[model samples]
Target: MRRNILPGLLIVLVAVIGNRLSPNFLDFAYLRDSATLVAELGLIAVGMNFIITSGNIDLSVGSNMVLTACITAKFMVGGMPAPLALLLGVGIGTLLGWLNGVLITYFRAPSFLITVATMAMYRGAAKALLGPQSVKAPSGIVGIDTQTFAGLTIPLLILLVTASIGAFVMQKTIFGSWVVAVGSNSRTALYSGVPVARVVRTSYTLTGFICGIAAMLMLSRLGLARHDLAMGSELDIITIVVVGGTAIQGGAANVIGSLLAFILIALLRSVMGVANFTAEYQMTIIGILLIGMVLANRLPLKLILQKLRPKSQRAP
Candidate 1:
């Protein structure tokens, strides 16, 4: 609890300091927009947390979002009902996720290679469907333009719902226990009667499902969809998950931490935008932060702390 609480407190502190530095950051509109952005990336990060906690990675989330957006765009362009179109988009995303799972589990392929291939395939399919064109949303989707609830954007609402569900799953379910166990040791989990393969496969499926949800929110927010949507979001998503304190090697994970991390990254981007920094510089800073966190994870900070403890207080 202390570990998780500390990161969130740090995020709040940074946000407060950032807002103080730039009064615009405290503007209701700016904060709302930041929440929306965090929600989008955070949704996928939550699923990634589950996957990482289950001892695997799903690199196909970006492509999955693209595919979902493309499918929704195609349906909307063809004059389909909005609800039906959205449903189709989600279904397509889930199917793609299942495909990833099947290949990785049944065929015994490495998850990294399988997801990488699927990522290309999914993105290629989106491009082929849309072909360098973009499509706008049809009429009647809520909050596409000129609306707000309690000063919060609709996208932020979506993000909040998604993150809440994710937190619930991680902290209050048998599936969560299985996820941790699988990450710790698949062999031991399997021997203990846990369905290791099934758990992993399900994680990818959930990843796709959440990406689909993000796709809908993004489409609604932008009022348009393009094959190129979320072109480089995979890196951002992974960075948020890592920064949230999920182990890359897969054992422990922090869903709430991932949420806070997403907010932190979004705030940083917003600050950078306000500061008029070039996009390249912002990316460089993010890259540096990612490297620093990775290095921190690898270091024996725990052992060092133990060694530094007072002799009287040290464990026997």
Candidate 2:
């Protein structure tokens, strides 16, 4: 309950501010439309939760997503079926994610450095494939943006579905437990017969697959694929996970928390945009938010509890 309070407060605060700025902000149609903008980033945030919870990070997520989208668009323009091209794109994402896992687990390199290098490499490769221009997607995919199911847009539906799956896996699966245990202590887990390497690989691979899904959604909404579809978005995704109470070191995460954080962020951005704030300034504000979260979390909870304790029950 406490974990959810911050995001809830943030949402209310943003809503209040937005109402003051624009009467149209609270309308159901406008809010639903805004969901489309956050869907792609939200998906990546959800995916990153798994990797972060399992004691790792992937800075290449933005590049991985763009690369997959670029590949998918290239195929679609080559007269391939949209569905088939999309599948291939997802497959590429999965493969890239698996590669990240393999390199990290087998080579024993730090995830931060490895992913950093791959981030540049993947983005460059994507640019090489798509050049400096936007590649338009086929009609089938371009039409996905306007798609709705039972009054919910396709991206929102997909976001909800992905979040549900993540929640289920984390709550009721052996794989989820392994990830937590590995992050808690790899040496102990390995000694206790847990397959640490496999767990790490699986976690990253899953993040990759989800990135693919997110890419397709982004492409559908934009109707064009670029070499920079999600450029530098890895920072926002990481911030979303960190702000959701996931530890950068390892262990502890909640999909719902991350989802709510994403919503708060999107709402804040919308309000800022309405106020005519520059995008560059918004990035700085978000960075400050991340730092504040980290600092507050680092505060001494025990000391606070001690201060709140009755004098009669005080310890030496």
Each candidate: RMSD: 2.2, 1.6
Give one digit per residue, the lDDT tens place, for model 1 in 247-302.
Answer: 88887888877877887788777777777889678778778777877787788877
**lDDT score for residue 295 of model 2:** 81
Best by TM-score: 2
Residue 100 error, candidate 1, Å: 1.1
Assess candidate 2 and give its lDDT.
Answer: 0.85
Model 2 lDDT per residue over 18-50, tens place: 999998899876777776787788888888988
Best by lDDT: 2
Clashes of each: 0, 0
Q: What is the lDDT, from 0 to 100, of the residue 167 in candidate 1?
A: 78
* lDDT score for candidate 1 against the true structure: 0.80
Q: Model 2: which ten-residue window has the lowest total lDDT? A: 139-148
